[model samples]
Target: MDRVLADDLHALHSLVSGLRRDIHAVTAAFSTSWSSGQVEGHVTRVKLLKRMGFGRANLDLLRRRVLRSP
Candidate 1:
């Protein structure tokens, strides 16, 4: 990181700074097997469904769509 900053590659410098700021998370991501992939997928799916039904979907319809979704 010091070397990167010294090299004055502004783009890489900013990226390294961000990685340094979140060093703990960066290390944990590399070290951990656990993830929120399933939860995130569900959230994304629900958001997509909601968007698809935009102005017309009521609670019941949304519930049914979620329940019926694969």
Candidate 2:
């Protein structure tokens, strides 16, 4: 951060100012490599399948689709 300030204080200040509220969260995310994208995708798939089955398919069919699709 000192090196960054030496090179460009304005940019450093801008970045810090922009991320002040979430500085800890942003730094933690960069330091760690955990994500919920796959879980989110599965949830999205389930939601879409449910919508597609809207009043037409029964629970059995929906269950089968979820199991088979995944």
Best prediction by lDDT:
1
| Candidate 2 accuracy as TM-score | 0.55
Candidate 2 local Cα displacement, residue 26, angstroms:
8.2
* lDDT by residue (tens digit), candidate 2, 14-65: 6766676688988998888899899999999999999999999999999999
What is the lDDT of every predicted structure here? 0.94, 0.85
Q: Pick the candidate with the highest TM-score.
A: 1
- Count clashing residue pairs per candidate: 0, 0
Q: Considering summed lDDT, which 10 consecutive residues are worst modelled in model 1? A: 5-14
Model 1 regions lying over 4 Å from their true place? 67-70
